[model samples]
Target: MARFTIGYRTVKTALGAAVSIFLAQLLQLDFFVSAGIITILCISITKRDSLKISGERIVACLIGLLYATLIFELLGYHAVSIAILFLLFIPSAVSVGAKKGIVTSAVLILHVYTVGEASAALWINELALLGIGIGVALIMNLYMPNAERDLLWDQVKVEDCFRTIWKEYAKYLKEGDSSWDGKEITTASTLLSDGKSKALRNIDNHYLRYDDYFYHYFAMREKQFDVLESILPFISTFGDTVIQGEKMAEFMEELSEAVSPGNTAGYFLIRLDELREEIKEMPLPQTREEFEVRSGLFYILHELEEYLTIKKMFKPDPKRTHNVSGKRLTRDLNKKGSKK
Candidate 1:
């Protein structure tokens, strides 16, 4: 058997359902159990989603009430009348983007049929149940646990992974080959994907305001990761180290140490330019093998420049107080808080 644990959403669902049912029963509404079901359905992963679905349910339920009264009264509450109502109602619900509330509205329409009348009192009672259920769900969703701390930690982990990957690349350049399993590449890819998803969920939680800081951060990392991936093939082609490889190895090691969300890319770009010129000024290769190695090193250098340029263009939000190594990250790490 799979182990089951109660998470925040689970607890909120249980509590919201109980509160909805209690409020409905207290108000003496018919079919009060349905209110609990509505609450369970309305509970969503994000506050905005909850509110959007709740609005859809309320609107669809009211539309269902109107259809149920008109059709059931006109057609004498027959089974065929319910079927006809659905044929017309399903299209109408879908057209208004209330398709998510179809089943919820169907339940209320059945309640109207069960009551066997279109009285104003019956409509008010059903509306009361709807309000109580959706209202309780909205209240329950108001206290989403803060995810910013976890997002910051993910950012740190991604940078650490980048540092490790660069160090591995440097090792490959310094020596012909290393025994690295290349797991950091896989790990960084997974972290970037997961981080982007969580950041998007965070965006959804803040409906009234815009917050895309973490989302853009992860996206920037993903672009840099693409550059890193492109460099891997170049590293694999080198079977022997040349004199240029040693210089490139040192540059890669330095880049590894500089893998925070900092703008130290400008300094690195200048250093890379000087390194290119130095390599150019060196004596010509004596053999084809040495020439190929030199060429691959230059290719790697070009890719590294692109990688750094990506970071240089990124502008992290200044107001965010996310920390790296227990120190607060400044608005411009290269110009302000960076060691460079």
Candidate 2:
């Protein structure tokens, strides 16, 4: 029973459908009508995908039913007609419905069951199953919205769209981590996309109102996207130079870690604020090529390290900062606070 419950989305769906089915007959509608409603409720969208899948399926099923009905009327309800219908009707309807297998199934079932005005029992059963399938799918989606899971791989692919630039950054930096290689960037993109999508999709479920939760979730994702965009070109140039002189790149990475934004060490932030002042005094590179191509990466790192340093000042490290740095530092960490 446990395995069976895990194997299919049946347990919850069955319970839902049974309750709906009972409600259907109780409402004086036929068993099929109740089942159909149940199915629709089950397969409804819980994520941000819109009714794209459900709409597609409904359309394909209707087309298949219509096509089957026409063929049966014109050619008679013979075995050959069913077979012919399978060939022409299935493919034709499926093409319109984007050729999704489930869509095709809905269409085929509707088509065959409604042929020649079948017994009411057959119609009821067919409608019930269709409704159950759709309803169950939707219910499952809404409760735990798989927007995160569904878009993960695709998001990874989209992030790779910026990979050429990042590779250049890594090359310029001359010191790359194979683990944090081009692939991990791709993976991070995917995770962010999935997370964002899931966050958006949780709007309609009958469970917790994740609308607020998702809002913050996607907002973070959007910030990550912006950060990656800003750093891409710089990383490319930095990586390329780092590769040219490995030791300097290593030193730079170490320097970065020493003052990284996540750390409690004040050295990175202080050095960066000082370096930003130095960049102001330095002469400009002669050309765009010189600016991007010939310039050393330490300068860029210094600028970034400086910016991160400033950003870090407000970020409190709770573990080490067990004792407060007075009210000033606490208020400073609050970016929105109106502190002079």
Instruction: For residues 131-202, write the lDDT of model 1, one tens digit per residue.
Output: 888999999999887787668767877887888898888888788667999998999999899999999889
TM-score per candidate, in order? 0.91, 0.43
Model 2: per-residue Cα lDDT over 1-340, one tens digit each = 3453342334545565665566555645433454544354434445333245656565665565666667776887777776776688667756685454344455445445445554455445455555555555565555443443333333333333333333434444574443444554565566566656555555544343443444343444345445555655555544333443343344344443332113443665555566555644556667675566335444455445544444444543343232322233334444433551
lDDT of 2: 0.48
Q: Let me know the TM-score candidate 2 reaches against the reference structure.
A: 0.43
* Candidate maximizing TM-score: 1
Quote the positional error of residue 182 for candidate 2 in Å.
14
Worst 10 residues of 2 by lDDT: 320-329
Query: Which runs in model 1 stand beyond 4 Å of their true positions?
Result: 319-340
